[model samples]
Target: MPLMSDGDEKVDGFFRLGTSSGRFNMFDRFASLGVKWTGAVNGRPEDEFGLAVVTASTSPDYRRSSAAQRTESVAEITYRAPLSPWLTVQPNLQYVHNPGADPTIRDAWVVGLRFAIGSRLID
Candidate 1:
């Protein structure tokens, strides 16, 4: 996360653009943009089905007031099935990225869920 510039020492965890020694120079600036998409599908034995989709984006001017900027995006999906009248389960997944970073962040994941529980009281 070190900002780079000519004739300047690389400082750790510090970010700056178009500047030297915390001074505005208006010569070292950059911009960024991004987009994402997500989708999912599900079905059941009794003719039940489901679908979903999501999209997100970030602009370079979201935070930085100087000439430098960064952007990111993420997407997700989910599916479900019916095992019985009172019981059901679903799974979820996601993806993320940041195209303006050194590592170009990327990731994926999966999750599970359940529903319908019976409780008994004993005296």
Candidate 2:
């Protein structure tokens, strides 16, 4: 989805929604949004930042059978460093509220890092 951007796609965002028509799928519905902020960061014009949030609900049948089933949500934040044209490093944080949509399961906070290396395209 092309979104508002600064030349070279510096800032952009997206929205998503999903629903299942099947009776067996556990996910009855879900939605999420993701945003990216790139370039012009803290004097470093190449750094990138991202944020996302997701919410999902258990299927009607599952919720009816499980007393603890309910809607669940997760949010994440990340920062990416461009080491070169072909390499980038990203550190991300994630927080889940009511994992598994089961009230008995405590929420969790997770931290992670990701690396991206790709070949530069030559014209």
Clash pairs, model 1 backbone: 18-28
Compute each candidate's TM-score over C-alphas.
Answer: 0.35, 0.83
Once fitted onto the true fold, the runs of candidate 1 whose alpha carbons sit more than 4 angstroms away are 1-53, 59-61, 65-72, 99-106, 114-123
lDDT of 2 by residue, 72-100 (tens): 89999999998878888999999999898
lDDT values for all models: 0.35, 0.84
Q: Which numbered prediction scores highest in TM-score against the true structure? A: 2
lDDT of 1 by residue, 38-108 (tens): 12122222322222333222223433443322433334444445555555565656554443322334444
Clashes of 1: 1
RMSD of 2: 2.7
